[model samples]
Target: MARIPTAELSRYLLSGQINRQGCLRLRRTPFLPRRPPCHNIRPLSTTTPPTSPAVVVVPLRKQLKDQAKALKSSGSSPRKKKKNSDNQTVPGWELTVGIEIHAQLNTSRKLFSPALVPESSLEEKPNTHVSPFDLAIPGSQPLFQPDTLIPAVRAALALNCEIEPVSYFDRKHYFHWDQPAGYQITQFYHPFARHGKIVLYSRDGIAAEDGDRIEVGIQQVQMEQDTAKTLAQPGGVNWLDFNRVGVPLIEIITRPEIHHPATAAALVRKVQMLLGAVDACTSGLEAGGLRADVNVSVRRPGEDKKLGQRTEIKNLSSFKAVEDAIIAERDRQIAVLEAGGTVAGETRGWSLGGTETRRLRGKEGEVDYRYMPDPDLGAVVIGKDLVEFLGRSMGVLPDEEVEGLMGRYGLTAKDAMALMLLDEGGRVEYFYEVLGELEGRLGGEGKGEGSYALLAANWCLHELGKLTEGEDAEPRTGLVTEFVAAGDLAAILYHLHRRKITAKTAKALLWGVFNCEVAPGGVTDAIERGGLWFQELSEEEYAMLADKVVEGEEGVLAEFLRFKQGKSKGYPQGKLMFLVGKMMKMGPEQNLDPASVKRVLGERIEGVYLPQLEGEEK
Candidate 1:
């Protein structure tokens, strides 16, 4: 628990500034940490910034050069190369990261108005969804909407946040074109929830041991209204789409527990999945439904007394950007400190194209935005009824889902996380649907450790995943629904499990079924129509195939003989096994048990080559 200096804290707490040439304003900052200074001094600018405070904006060219140098130093090339172990930080320093994520709740109407909220305001004409309140009409008064509270509480529960019994709203003053009211409504003084934790796993897919696991603490979860977007039209025109104005948002704040770039990225990803699971928000980062602001600081390896000055990177669009920004910034700061220059406490912006960040503004020089409790909206009281309803209706959390899948289906941690990490919920739904159908077909469940469950898991993640990947990854639609029904997929896997069809035939059947027209007699019928039926070879047939392979390749026989004499460089038994595999696959439609084929091949090889060895010894 390092203490941040109060003078430095002032820079982060207050954000208001006036330009010498003109009046410039920005968005509202909801809350700031309050830590008293060890020694008090006269304040510089508590309410407004003084004129011409020398704001040092990093030059674009310098930033670009830094990005290039960083990339080259990190060994990035035009062609993708295997990630080097050097990417991890050196042992002398530690990285600290905290995240603030804003997710728009999935609601039809605005947070405080009857205005309909569209997924994208760009899709509709300008201002079509705007209500009087959205436009800041003089007579319209604010109305508190309660529907947004349920989802917020649900999200808090999913994240293990402690819900506040009473929550209230406040107005943060900032003048912006998108904020027609000259202020934003948010829960700052009294947020909806606080003090939660998110668990993190290591790369090995095993939950880290209790002492080793990284558990990021949730500082607070607050409800707020989204501002409108200032859109640029064709032909030098710009307009405001108020459709997004006043839309509900849940701001999740995390404690500075993340120490690695990869872990920070994983934290964001896990939160997104959890949000989607609880139906709080869609977690579509590209579509603007969710975004994160990262706070990063660095300190000496063993120093726990003071955290270095942190810079905030705002509005990262994707998890990749989050990871990249943290790494780049961390390296940049360390380089600056090593060169005897100080790291600036300021806001920065990340360019997705360049994979770097640029200075937005100096934190110390910014002006403060005044905040006060809103007069119109009363405090919201969460009763037992609503809490009970939320507790019951809130579905499986992301972590719980992973554990359940692993326990019930006997899946590996990696496999479980693969399905859980899918951005599209349909993929997860389809996986379980197929899993359930397969389980039922396999005669109820004892433990999913059986061959059928393992095969189904592979097909679901690899083959079915491939089919559902790309722009059309939506579940239960198009190819997912049209071609492969759950029952059909389950039947195919079931037949493969029962050894009624070889793995090769089953794969062929799956692809053929996907590309084929509607089958008149279902998947089994389609398998028959496509001539994918497995043809099992008898014992005699197996022996004949093995004999043909052994007799046809004199070189292979020579290698086997050399191995028997202990003269071969490598194991001849391995070569023999390889030959057996090739011999089995020679006939495409032939389905012989691999064990049976191996046994027959061993007999043929021994009968033919052992006598030669015996003769040579004599």
Candidate 2:
């Protein structure tokens, strides 16, 4: 018989516990590798084996203390403190964050079964959208759905991922009430797409012209089946909602590259935009259409190569929660490490109003889940032609759209981002449609594109956005688009640009049309019906009105004259505007332009009032 080497025995002894009599015995754990049969080997130690089968367990806090002492005694020095983006500093720690986003694919059918994917709304009934295959009944076979592939591919391409020609699925075995099949079908060994990047700007532009941006590396985007939702009822009874079971989901994993809390939130927001742009997912965090799992860790400043223990915060439903959870976890880890303790790797849950993350369970390793390729479902073979077709149909991604808005329309980065970030492409489309109409009507003959583009962006983001801002219960954007046609808005802007209507009159017209208070006719009809057109006044008329107003308001005229002569402590321009407002109120039906009124008032002050005052003083 072969004998076990002393070195091997020593290595095995290191992993086990030493009894009172000095007998070394190994404890079997799911994560550890299997050892050789004990009957085949002779005992090397003189001490007898422990009589009891129970293994000695050490407290986790004590283990952490011992590890911290060991590291301290090893002569390792702490690194210098660093400042984060918010200018906050932890004395000797650095934060690292990574996000796992699971977005429900926007397909009619589930991922594996032929059952319909539920709407997942509050009014949806439970267990109505399930199939025999989803429940894992006997004689039911798992079949892959081809409808989910296109959206997944489009999303991967939008994130700049490289799609694999052939990818296989694996079964991650676990026992949970929500998992009806006792295992989740996922792409474990080989995902469909990998190696992508999402660039988050510090401000609004894709290029990050201010030299501040984060390039988060995408590890992989894999398709998987979502588990059912388990709702806890009274008296410890749990209700299962199988409506969401077997729903198609694409899990996007990112490399641990994020550091700041805001950056983490920005990455989530950017991912939502990308997925929504491709129409691959609903990307609505509130409706459970999208969920995020955040992995956060903290290390010393110079330990970039060596990461510390990370904890996973699961199912953060909102961007604010994502940022706050990261910050809270980071501070918790720093506190543990600074107190001469070690941080544990575990899964945590965050409440909406809670300040700290609560422990859910210990983190599971790959070995614990016992991952293996699915024998029933064969490999997914994607053709190059299909990939190319999906890529062609991707239309335009969010970053590309932002660049187009900036370059083509000469919009500021802030304005462009405002339009794009409102609600995917709706506001941007409205802006573009209005701008296109304006360009067609007023592109030539000394009409500047920049001015019209700015006008359109302002109206879309400010005016139209205000109408649909808080109306989240309804499809407010669709309602506004249906009611206010793009051509009508463009015509209103064109008339305003041509100096034929006052700015106030244009705004009132927009509000009236949006509220259905005005007729649904064109801008010309609305203006003509309301008699809101600009009433041009000749120089003689303006000068006579200016003289009449100046003569009527003696006190204001005295203040204006004194200010012009540097003898008063009041704003002469404001007094002039007050008089111009009085003049405007005199002709209520004229719809006089404020700019023209201000311009003529300034001319009267400069050419008439000041000269007259100088003559009187002389």
Candidate 3:
């Protein structure tokens, strides 16, 4: 038997432990072949991030069966599962959870405050956008945000939420190191809307899960002003970013009824989609924008509907992160229960490397929040008339707008949706308006009049979508001003619709203008210049070609006679198209449709490639 290689065999033997990333790495044997080095063993880098304290689960497939056998045979110390006097699991695994999502309201001004100078005008620095009310200096007063509230009210009503007649703004008092004002302006007693549910969908556009069909219950939705962010440091110091200090935000507080992590994730996704569905929201979880604070807890396996001590995971930016944090906390609590230990209630931070939850701090209840009414801004009067006006006048829901566009303009499904998605981006409606005028022009000009909606949709989705998609910046809808005259696009499309020019010709012409290959109108004029026939075959040229063919060979006359008698055989028609192409090659390069060439050639080729060839004996 050959001796084991010392360096290679070192890994399998008991050896000294070397530290790497806080995990133990075994030392390799000093002896080894110098040329062919041991490449298999990699040095563990000490760059792993710190993780949460939790029992690690080793993955072993048959370990559980082995455990059961040992459990059955061994004598062990008693480990008692916690139970109440009546024999119920104390702080039973049953726990309730709810999500409070705070979405920034898109408006020109801040709520209960005047909008600041535009960020573009200010020098590059923080806290520059701060108005008097934002700084919360003595005697600083907040003004009402009417325009901001309109969209907010519209959004809540669209969610099928119940709005209060007399909603009030309140002060959520707290003294965090970041709180310059000593409290945040918020709502508590009565919020703007309540009992709304958002259907959740994932990034892949699939609903994750459902607890209750139709609507998940929302507890309340409040319109409030946001606090400034505290940029904290590791040592002790933290700076303040007041750019977002007084921005208007709407918080939708949910009920503690979501049954699973998947259902919860799905709910958040649907809310995002619905917001998009109405053009009331940008995509969710934008940079330093919309966020959710999740309350997580699990119930016992046998418990019907009981809740356990819930923990809060605050201000997760994305839905997937929320899903992960919830599952981690739930599993951690389950592990504690199974180990004959009790789980404590605390705010948790999620460690991404290993799916586990860490205790960030103790959880806070309503008492800890210490909510009180704001002194400056009084109760908002949400009267019956105001509610009716706001609800009815909020603007059409996105799905409804899409349907209306489709119905009014006869747009295809893809085109209609694209228009609604454009929001403030495109001149979508203006395109349809021009289509109406084109029909009149076509009738007078004796051109084919295809349906304008289909044509417009084709132009917008297929042509324009491709034309502008990779632009360095967002395409300007205002660029429609250049196209408003109906000279460029209208002329090209009209020519095609009239069948005066083929689609290939129209497309080529449009591309030429767009690419500056030709002046915008240069392509349209070239059609007339090319002389509709491939060439202006003069009478002399035409007669000479026909005479040449007739005199070239007696075999040609025999072939013509065979074709006439329906007995010609062994011929290829594709070659005839090539001949026609050659015949026109020296002619003007008009935008010729290959189909027209095929059509003309079929008549001349006779039964060459057809079932009955020109020389066939049939």
Off by over 4 Å in 3: 1-99, 115-125, 141-143, 197-213, 229-239, 256-289, 292-304, 307-362, 404-419, 422-455, 458-618
Candidate 1 segments exceeding 4 Å error: 1-85, 120-126, 203-212, 233-237, 301-304, 364-367, 442-449, 468-483, 552-577, 588-618
- Write down the worst ten-residue block by lDDT for model 3: 81-90
- Residue-wise C-alpha lDDT for candidate 1, range 49-106, written one tens digit per residue: 3442422445445666787677778888345422422454636788888999999998
Q: Per-residue lDDT tens digits of candidate 3, residues 1-618?
A: 444444433332212122332223334556843344233323222122265132233323244456545655776522543221122122445545588888777676777677563332123255556676675655568888777666677768877788777778887877763555788888888787787765432331222333234346888888877776554434443445565677788888888877566566656655654565545543366333468778887668486455776788877766666666776677677787778887687787763222466778887777888888777777677667776886666666645666666676677556665564442324455465446656655766642333655786577556655455565323544343243234567677766665677665666666555655656545567677755323233444543443333343345445545555568675545455554565445333353444544454454444333334433646
* Highest lDDT scorer: 2
- Between candidates 1 and 3, the one scoring higher on TM-score is 1
Clashes of 2: 0
Q: Each candidate's root-mean-square deviation in Å?
A: 12.0, 15.2, 19.3
- The candidates, ranked best first by TM-score, are 1, 2, 3
